[model samples]
Target: MTQSTTRTSSVPPLPPPKERRRLREAKAMTEKQVAEALGVTQTTVRSWETGRTSPQGRRREAYARLLETYAAELDEKKHAKRKRRSKNPENAATARPAPETEAASTAAPTPSRKKPLNRRPVRTVQADSRSRQNAQRRKEKAAALAGAAAAEAAKLTPAQAFDELYAYASPALVRQTYLLTGRRTLAQESVERAFHLAWHRWPEVAVDRDPAGWVRGAAYDYATSPWHRFRRAHRHPDPPNGERAGRALRKALLDLPPVYRRTLLLYDGLGLDLPETAAETEATTPAAANRLLHAREAVAERLPDLSDAHVLHERLRELTETVSAPAVASAPAVRVSSERRAKFWTRAAIAVTVLIIGATAFTVVTAPRQYEPTPAPGQRVGGVPAPMGPQKLSRQDLKLRAKLRDVPMNGPERLVPRIP
Candidate 1:
């Protein structure tokens, strides 16, 4: 009898815990199933997958082999599914209709209708060119019209521009100020003052992207300014049915930070959108949105019953509208006399002319002075001759120089006292 030798093969290394978990997922095996297949606790499989602990010895080898077998099975199933799908692609694309009964089939078959063709009319080259030229002419005409309109607008005086803007913006600004200040008189005053400033600086204000926003900001500042603190002592009459909610809303709004209060008023009180509110508040859109959110939260906390934004906005509108805004006149009142205006212009011209003269004088006085260039070596400068070389001194001159060296340089020269 001859003895046969048995050769053992080495097991491959196991992948990392994450890779093991991914492989298990690929195989569609849950942790419990994988644990049961390897004859281990589900917790142990979880620990292995989570990298807290791992399988060892025979368990590790078994797990790896099980995962390999499952992966191969999954691949085989996928390949079979693909092959089946390819074999009957139409069946895969759409569900097959149930087989018709013999009686139904014996009935008349429905006629099939063909889909209509979508054919675009072809254009000739000449027609295409003509159409292109017509479109170009229309575009040029539109551009010219736009330019002419802009030129006409530019020709309007600053006062005219202010009149146009003020007519539409004054009422809204007055209402917004009323919401901010909670005083009808102060609100009216604030709107008037802001518009007055805008009127005075119409040349500058009209060029701004949002002149209405500028006026709104100015009015808000005026309404909240400390100079108008005297108005707080005076009580204003509230409209009918607005006493309680108006007081509560005013107290809540006043308690908020200025930015938050302004944001809330612009967004909810005035029905301005977020971007428009941001422009009015001199803040970025996101920052304005955040301020509005914070304001709403704060107000909601104060008045729990009125937590909804729409409800709060409606309530605020009612409160603001209760106090009627001052009527906007067709034309702004001219407060300054014609003589005062003339005097103001005259003074401004004098100041400007004085500044120009002063600047000219300063330029002349501080400017570099012109002078003749220094003469070259061996040439005469002014009336003095330029020294050509070192000069030989006489005995008297040398004695004079030695005497000068012994004299004090800074103060008066004194003769040295000789020793007796």
Candidate 2:
């Protein structure tokens, strides 16, 4: 018979006993299972089992528990090996005592000393300083922002405060105005005028629950003013029949029978919800308001498309830019001529008084002289006789009278002043 040959596969290296035990325990799996899972030979698994090398890092955890289990099995196998050796008396006797040399007798070679640990104190300090600097910069920036915000808030006046509130409501106002007027110019003018009205009554307006509602009301009234419509109707005067279209637009407005244009402007523009709109428009309710709104819509639809917002914005921005700041507070007041006024009235009064006095004095002077008439000589002597030389008619006067008898009465009439 041929001699049979048996060959054992070589095992891979592993770390010391403690590491092997930890590796097996950490894996929480058996050695055979771990070897099969890793696609390794059983000899390789046993190598890890015998403590010649260790799995590094993350891989160590995967196999720690598994290898530990394998290590326990190895321990049992080692015990069996010792037992067998002890029981085989002939084989044990062959384990003869060794002759001890000094070098051999010396304690088993001590393990190499481990390197000292390196502490990174400078790196730790640098990281701490960087963190503190970042925190300080953030604090300073936050403080500056807070200060700016506070200053801005402090600078706002009551009028500006109200303007901001109105601005918040401007989008709604724009929509409302566009729908109602069908002309951007009209809408913008109406809004500005309305704001002016609101400013005039701001003391009362600001206290209201909704100041925007008041503004809308004012805008409606402004837009629908007969004067406004008339001006728009006659806006163009130079071109041939230029004023006709304007007249027609005005006629349409004036022809609108019952509903006030104000109610229509608010209902159509601003999108004031029914009840609120009614309150602003002074309508009875949503139903009544709708009637006015519908009426305005019918008329507005016939007009040109004048609701381009971009155009409106440009126009408005231009208007704002063109408008000069009022110098009311800074400008000198108009110097009315008080002295001129006073002098005029004074002269008039004096003239009237003098005329009245002259009329009265004339009447007084002329009244007394009228009562006494000169008495004639032959008349009853209620008055003194005329002067003697004039009492009797002279001979020459008689001769003249005889000659006058023949003459015509009108040719030479005698002057008779003697009778009163």
Candidate 3:
């Protein structure tokens, strides 16, 4: 059917949320069953029931019709139940009081008024009620404050949020990155580049639930990016300090797989929850936990003294602190650099686009407009050559020809110019 016809098709009205659920339940149907019958997901059926979204187009019509059928079935079932009850005299009799009993109950004498039951003192009751109300008010106030804070956070502009995140996260990330890659320069460069990227993608970072984590992931990825192997500065790792424990721990970390190392850092070093670590490292929770376990075991074997997570965290912190780097790049510097980089890329893209357009236009201009059939490889004779006209015979040539014709009776010998 055409869109207009589909739009105008009368999809039957559906009951409200409660009624919808009641109808389904009365029909002894589950959301899954209904979803299967309608060729939709259980979540879709749930959304329809909860009024989050309504099915549209053919699905809507189908669902509405299905509900109607379910309602009809329920009605039939109810009618059957009513008929059965009516046919069962015992049940019907128990369903309503006899007319005589009802009259007798009404005619029965009223009992004497009893003393007022012991009641809670008004003061105590009022105090308890007041206390409960006060408690509720306090809870509501706390909730409101939390909501207000969240709203305030939400109100921040993308740049403001990004700047805030950068200011808070960049320095620590720089240090953490140093721990990840043993190079201070790479750490600074990676952190700055990561921030530049975050600034460039501020809109996404700002809306992200974990902006810090987002930035951290980027920094980690850049710090450990495989292509860095080709860079002269990254060809060899920075030498570890005199501390044997720190050296061994760094060695152990380097020995671990990239994913496992990242997981360990996120879980043990940064003290993130297993799930959060898994999310950041892009691994399953169990995998992350397993990585953390194996990493810890490896590190413990390498540096038994620093086996405890707390001690390991402290040692990592100490190791990062051991490397003294200059002050970090400011958020504004990163933001400015990001803007400059983006501007450069944008101009480059425009230039490339313009070049393409120019090339296309030139091609269009230079292109042959109309189809011209290619001539054959051989040139056409300019004019049909005058069919070999007989040249006026020279006197000698004419005499030779007449003599040959007169001697024609000599057979082949005549053509060979033999004397008669």
Candidate 4:
């Protein structure tokens, strides 16, 4: 066998993690701008700066090259400042050049000066302090501009924004729903339905101050709906498992009324403030606080270990996070489904309207136009009796007739007689 030599590409070295941020800021570049240049997400760039992750392969090379360019520009700016400083006669006379070590660190940036015109040491110190303050203000202004630019660059269309929101919120929402409903399938359906509704009502949802909260409310409502009990699929409760505390906690949550459970989850599990929880639950703050109290009492009754609010929050969050979430359909699919459902309901409504119109038209064609009243029911009365068959004589009438036949006819009875 013959040995063969091969050449490989080497990735360039990156600056220290802390220095990465300094370099980018010093260069007056936004994370968005750097991300676009490197063909990555701004989050990835942030991760690189934060030392959570490092770039690799061509990306590593690209990042290193970009940082190097920023370094070069900073060096150029430093040189330009030196040239300006040297050209000023007053500063050049007294001020010596900055040592290499003093010029190296960029953590604190100070204005370059050749000399002080006053030559008063105390005034020079005061002036330098003012310059440092000015430099800090400049840094803050630059950072603000960078943030605004990033936000502008990240502007997304409605569909794109919805998709992003769905991606960010759905998985966690499913888990939350699971904790609420205790059923994997129900949780999955609830989350998907909520998103579908959100997409259908995108105009309302997109402009909402808390779009996630809006969707969350819808999901929680659906997950805890009493109507779900009528469905064969959701008639039964999901079996609880895991540690004693977790199962007991889930059972306690399920046992509580939907409103109380929701309040507790919002306040404890999700960490919403009382006012926010109340707003999301559509209840007054006091009502929400009361519900939270009752819910906590119920849970504490079962498991004394969770009597403390912090302990309950920890257990609830852990249980929700540990449960596996069902995979949700893509945002596009959800929007399409919502459109289909809306169209179906609309067509059904039109059909019903047409049927009603037809019924009215039939009534108009066949209904009697003349004035007619309902006939009074036949009734026997003293003035005008209904014609009925002759009734049989009673025993008393027969006896009276027999007595009349046996005795001589007496004076005509002073009574009214029937006319023939």
Candidate 5:
């Protein structure tokens, strides 16, 4: 008997492995289930999904068909769900409402309902009141402690005060100076100079209302002075590393004008108050406030994420900590000896006296000389006899006088003849 001949066509190309995996996951089918259906190990199916090894021959055809079927099934399920929701709108709405109400009721007890329970007992209420009063008493005790600390601080010797301030303030000043100057050595030098000044004036500085502010102001001045510029010109330092966040922040900060940069760093970066920042920058409080606002806008324009005060402050803190100078355990005292101070005053007084004497000498030498004018023949003198009414004229004098008398009167009257 002759059997009917049948032809089998080749399977089309399967979707990419990633696409296959996505389709399988969409239908919530595990690799094991797909593997069991395909009569293969789950590891084989995993390889196929991960694109490590693809199925070959008829297996490839079966895999493609499986993914397609599952994707279609997922779509059908979603469509069926939507259709049911549309057909029984009231039933679906009522079904959701009960669960939502249950959830809300459950969550409400966690916060508001439980709060009333804690508040229900009179004893608890009394305890809370007592706790608040205790907190107030603690605050008063803290204030007293602070006052005693201030008194103790006031009693510290100049050297002790200097050491304390140097330890506490040097790091912050160095960081602030670096931001202002953008040079490590220059920043260090500026801080050193500032502290030196503080050391010399510690007697006064220790008693000042805001010694830190004074030091900060001095550091700023030192950072911005012409001497620093000259030094910077002579020695050009390399920029910060490109990989660090501080590089971008430092560049943005340096782009700002000195006034705005100092105002911003002092106010936000160093945590100085508005008035203190103003004093540091030599600006009025309102002017400093305006500068801070403008500076924030300027920095935000450059680095948008660092616009918030808190964010910028944190960023600056991080950058500063990265480049801060080591704490100085001891610094040389700048206080002049009493003899030296006396000599300085003596020299100053001598200089002043010399200046006064030189000025008097100069005046006497350069002044104009006074001379008395000789009286004319018939003119009167203030302290002398009036010339005798013209002496009798000799013939020769008479002739010369007659010759001069005939000459025209060359005066204002002659130049501008009187109107007739």
Candidate 6:
């Protein structure tokens, strides 16, 4: 179906200003009274009531207040009508009606007279009503309490569940991956793949006393995997040789052996103490972990700008400290593409046109010299063999030869024709 450009008016378009005035008048309030309540001039109120203009912003607030007062007055009028019908003027004027008159009023009780007897039933009714209300209140309270308990149960602490583990493990993970593959891409990929594996089994994994251990194991396997290891070897074919801190550090980190690099990162980069590193790495003690760290330090000595162990440590510290937490990954949403595909095709056509125009401009700016075919050697004006190639020369070549009839050649075959 085609969409509408112009909006359709509703069946009763809108009430006219005259009709609104009638409605206001029916409520027994003058425009002046409403204007006084709204803090507006009587003329403004008259304009709105007559639909000459509509109230807006704070004026609407005043209009709404006036309407509410009108409604209350109508309710009062209704109550007064009902009271007049229910009460006899004589009974209304007296403090208490005589017993006979009261009985006479009730013989065929009208709605007004019936209200007393109906009201007399309220004592028992009030007790029942209060009991029902109290029961409802208790039920609501119980439900709210249960809801609170359920909410508390569902809450999981990310700081405890992931942050602690991340802080404890990230450095080691980064370092180990870097060392094994000797490439930044491999190390990063391995770490991500390892976490992906852990996330897949979070329920069972979280219950384990040593979740980080599970993650490290997963990471180690990923780094050592045949496919991953191959990729790591070729990850950074051209490591930049520069003084930029991040680039140098990236290059250095990518050059480590898997084990020592992992150990160093876990121990230093991630701020994991030796014991934690040992647990994650499945090493026996802090001494073994320290030995691996020393090995990494020794390797750092060989790199050009990384002269001192302290320098490498400081660089690593700075990089690691400045690192922001990794963002949470989300499942890709399923997309509906018909509309998007149309938009894409439209944009692509426009882009192609722009590109073609730009290419035309570029060609004109860097136009190559026009090729003029050389006249065939010793060939005459009208019958000369084309000098250039297998293809026949253009008429311009003939013109040049005719214009330069006095030109000389060293030999018939001396000037080898140029090959484009």
Q: lDDT: which candidate is best?
A: 4
Candidate 2 TM-score, C-alpha based: 0.29
**What's the TM-score of each model vs. the native?**
0.43, 0.29, 0.55, 0.55, 0.47, 0.33
Q: Give each model's whole-structure lDDT.
A: 0.70, 0.51, 0.75, 0.79, 0.71, 0.58
**What does candidate 3 score on TM?**
0.55
Candidate 5: list runs displaced more than 4 Å: 1-143, 225-238, 241-245, 284-286, 324-330, 333-420
**For candidate 2, lDDT tens digit of each residue in 1-420?**
223222111222334433443455444655566678666765565555432233564346445544545677878877899666544543332233234533443555323212222322354458658977998999999999979966885687656756575666555564455334445566666666566555555565554546676677666666555575467553422222233333433334334542444444333433344544444443335455567656555555654442443332343333223322211110011112223445677899999999999999999888786578788668555677766565678999999888877655562235443355
Output the better candidate (5/6) by TM-score: 5
**TM-score: which is higher, 1 or 2?**
1
Query: By summed lDDT, which 10 consecutive residues of candidate 1 come out lowest?
Result: 112-121
Question: Per-residue alpha-carbon lDDT of model 4 for 39-128, expressed as tens digits?
Answer: 999888877764446787778878998898898899999989965664564454335445653565344555534335546456556766
Task: Report the poorest 10 consecutive residues by lDDT, candidate 4.
Answer: 1-10
Going through the candidates in order, what is the number of backbone clashes in each? 0, 18, 0, 2, 0, 13
Q: How close is candidate 1 to the true structure, as a TM-score?
A: 0.43
Model 6: residues with Cα > 4 Å off, grouped in runs:
1-153, 156-188, 209-213, 224-227, 231-243, 303-312, 321-420
Instruction: Put down candidate 6 lDDT per residue, 1-420, tens digits, no spaces.
Output: 123322222112233344445457566666677778778888786656433356776566556555656557778998898666544443443435568867766675556554543242444457657977998999999999978965764485632455445556666566555544555565566666666555545554555545766676677667656564245456443344342546555556656655566676666555666645554554434454666666566656656566565666676666665543223222111011223445677799999999999999999989877888888689446866767757676899878766556556556533555468
What are the root-mean-square deviations of the candidates from the true structure over C-alphas?
A: 28.4, 43.7, 15.2, 20.1, 34.5, 30.5
Error of 1 at 294 (Å): 2.3
Candidate 3 lDDT over 47-130, as tens digits, reads: 676443567778887888999998998889888996565345443343444788556656883331122333333555576679
**Is 3 or 6 the stronger prediction by TM-score?**
3
* Residue 289 in model 6: lDDT: 60
Please say which candidate is ahead in lDDT: 4 or 6: 4
Cα lDDT for residue 33, model 5? Answer: 90
Can you write out model 1's per-residue Cα lDDT over 298-360, one digit (the tens) per residue? 999999977998898998777666645556444446324323555788899999999999999
